[model samples]
Target chain A: MVSLQAAVESAAPVSRLHERASFDPADFPVPGGREEEWRFTPLRRLRRLHADGPLDAGKAGVEADAGPEITVVAAEHGDPRLGTAFVPADRVSARAFASFREATIVTIPGGVAAERPVVIRVRGEDAGQAAAGHVLVEAGANSSAVVVLEHAGSATYADNVEFLVGDGARLDVVSVQDWARDAVHLSHHHAVLGKDATFTHMAVTLGGDLVRLAPSVRYAGPGGNAELRGIYFADSGQHLEHRLFVDHARPDCRSRVTYKGALRGDGAHTVWIGDVVIRPEATGTDTYEANRNLVLTDGARADSVPNLEILTGEVVRAGHASASGRLEDEHLFYLTARGIPVEEARRLIIRGFFAELIGQIAADQVRAKVTAAIEAELDAMARAEGGAR
Target chain B: MSTLEIRGLHVSVAAQAGESREILRGVDLTVTAGQTHAIMGPNGSGKSTLAYSIAGHPKYRVTSGSVTLDGRDVLAMSVDERARAGLFLAMQYPVEVPGVTVSNFLRTAVTAVRGEAPKLREFVREMNGAMAALSIDPSFAQRNLNEGFSGGEKKRHEILQLQMLNPKIAILDETDSGLDIDALKVVSAGINAYRQSPDHGVLLITHYTRILRYVRPDFVHVFVGGRIVAEGGPELADELEASGYERFLAMEGAPA
Candidate 1:
């Protein structure tokens, strides 16, 4: 007979007991394949990021540069606002929280508006090394700013990032994971919005062996607004996942989430989960979330799940939707019926899918870079498939 | 001079559960350069299938027939290949291709058909000229192809593509079906300009002769149950206009 803890610690990948989100690492157990959240993720391919493994701060390289109106510091350890935004919902994020060596803090002065976006670049050096990272960002009252976090290179990385928005502040965060093919990344992003504050989070994932990201939003006061948007592309042998949660804890808050992804080639898989909860006390709340996935090849698979938990019938409105489908045959016929070839039509459709989101990027340079990357990925997909199906 | 010749053309489409139903049973017609042939038929008479079959739509299978464009075997070509071989099909219901703007869609088609991309200035001038002729808004060029477009807009957009492509043979499938009188005039004017090309051949498919008032046909064929049962001069359209297809539907043990 095997004990529950022993069973969870065992090598066999099975389902473990469930627990609510916890900030403490001990509150969570090693994830088996059966856990609701972990079932879609490939455990064996995670490179020990989900189980007990080496997490070295020295092995990871992070470079941070803040704008003139912003202040940045490398703190040794605990900040009272660290876990207030979001508790760890999985073992990997909890382990990252418990094992993070040094934390970076980005701060904006009260009522000071930043003209330029702050930039942070994280690059993993050794492919064999597993690393944990933590970042805390706080926006002062009535201050507005944008933050960009770009990831690249190769490593097994698990990290947590939190955003604390002050009243009447407007903040936009664009987190891009353009990792190497051998890299594995698991991250949790939590943003807490103050009264009348507006927050926008955009996640763009293009490269990784298996990258799982969960971004959640919570209201610290009434009249807060949150917008979450994401775009991802998965090629052969790549697994990319995004999970989002919007918790409307205060009254009269509004939230919107839209995510679009494309998958191509054999073994390419993408999973998107969107959850919105309107608490009973959160009357007059309005929220909508949608996820759309387009599969471009025969072997690629996309899974989209949208859940809405509305406890208050007095709320203004709430809805959620998720859909995943292959390239529409009617769209293809529309193009081929013209003189355009099948391959070119496929390219145009995929480009059109990402054009709307890419247009929302305020930084022209970043927008151009992301567009170039998308075009490159489309070219690669065209080459791999030889022609359109 | 160009010509689209169909000889004993028979087409079938797969029905549910692996059954094949013949839509076109021996359709025979010939369209020559500088000539407009209006094929008038009732509903379910397979007029649209004839146009689609000529464009190499995969849904319509050519069982036993010959469709040749200027002595070239058009039935052997792929859909895009057929379009490149000087064949253009203005669909009855233009498909909505989301994310692809009208400008991009036309540019791609023109490039594929002409084997070279048009000069930017020339392309813009031509597009503006065509849009002006059709009374389409300049902003329509930036909109996605046929998406959320009204029926009249879709028809005008189709003619816009026809004007840009300049194909040898143009098949207009129910181009006048949903157009208001005003839109019908604009679309007919665009087609008339294409007709001015000395080598252009037009095969107009319509259930009503309302469009014939604007774009006159040199020959009219009465199609019923996929075959041309009667052929006559322009007077035939007037005869059909005055007397409906009830005369043809009355024939028993024969194609409707």
Candidate 2:
């Protein structure tokens, strides 16, 4: 019963109107604490990383682990492939784009199937210092690969990750933000899918003082498919946010988005924004988005917004849904009345809530690690509350 | 020999517009091992309240009562404690848990009740045998518990648990309400099998006497106006079926 991580599968989406895209840091000025994107964030807690601060990583670094069929290149600024598939939408993304002296470029050879995942480990060694990073992953035509961008340690950091999926390629990227409790990290992910290509992105954010991510996808040709999935847990005094967008500008494209989150303790806050758009020329486009949140204790807040805009009447399907609530008393009672302890019952329900998304993870070690981390969070909450709740 | 003793149980529920309505008023009943007591009543006559109160449902406030099992105060125990104390209630309406599969739920309940986890192979073997006996598909073991299940499936699953948990006393609340003839027979067989064990007792609550034809009760009690009005042997069920509770409804002073 402790390892039922593989059995649960299940959600449905929310949206807020937004229109801001730029590559120049000047074009996107510092958030004055009142903008829609920065309102939920505590500006003072950012440690002035949003201002004219240091961008050199100093001790923070990135390391790649891959097989011989793949190439991990370190290219300097003005690398032609660095920003070809990415556009900085916010000031943090723009600053991260302008500040990095070098970027990590990962290329998977065409028609090559990797036996193991390409793990890009981003680790920080200092908590008081600020840094920015950039990584671009190119999946060659007919290639199949899984890239894991894992973050750990402590630092004030910002980064931009771009994935260019070539024709008939399949690329799945999992970004896990298991940072130190004192770390503040922000990131943006841009993905472009070619004809008949398949792309998937999963975000796992469990540890950090403040973590925000925006992952967007664009279809570059017809018959492309993209799916976005995320699972996150916020502890006491933590902020986690994810903003997602999927654009269908080509005919015969499909997209799906689902994210689930749980928050416990005082001042625990989480947010999800899903925006999907189907344009006029995009005939036969299909899309749906959903977000669900569970608030385990008092003083925690979760905001979910799902928006779907369709300018063409020729599309097949377009829908969205959002739900944010506390645990159901009936579920707890059902489990407890069957002889399960109340604490164990609560743990099961919370784990089941996130199992739907976590079950989709293909890597066994990564899934086990995520499960262990969440279990630790649940244990901490039980100790703090003394199982009374 | 195990026995469940109930004395002077008074239960109430919250009513609309800031008021309280009594559901079980000074009712008393007892069931010893090897006994099946059938309590038949009309609609809204507090039959379910008796079953729920005995199971420690939070909605049923036990204003004044005492329920004990072999000298232990069952009223002092929480819901799970009651189950661990050898009391079970096969609920008429089982709640649907979205992600917990049937097999996982059954194993968890068995472990909690038994106080030790069973071996995986042994558990699966027992589960498969029980499932086959109940005529349930093996694929149902992976489906979520009671989620998107038919009425018959839910009822059969309840009896399956009744057999699996093997509690000392079981209060079956309307287990045959929505069952077809075949399902009713299967579920009744499951219940009968559970009753075969020594130190096991049953309190079957229902509105009709059709199920009595299959699983005969040892005693029949006429329930009306939140209390038992009459008690007799199994023949009383046949008499009540022939002549409905119309005469019993007109008996002594009853509250609306």
Give candidate 1 regions above 4 Å deviation: A1-19, A387-389, B251-256
In candidate 2, which residue ranges exceed 4 Å CA deviation?
A1-18, A387-389, B251-256
Best by TM-score: 1
Candidate 2 residues B1-256, lDDT tens each? 8999999999999999978999988788999999999999999989999998988888889899899999899999998999989888988899888778889888999999999999999999999999999999999999888999999999989888887888999999999999999999999999888988767999999999999998889999889988888899999999999999988887535642
Model 1 - which docking category? medium
lDDT of 1 by residue, A1-389 (tens): 11224322433223222227776767778888897888899999988788888777436678788777789988765767577777787888888988888888899987988888888889988768899999988999999998899999997899999899999999999999999998899999989999999999999999889999999999999999998999999999999999888887789999999999999889999999887776667889988898999987788999898877666666777877788888887777778877889889888888887878888875666788899999999889877766544
TM-score of chain B of 1: 0.97
Isolated chain A: TM-score per model? Answer: 0.92, 0.93
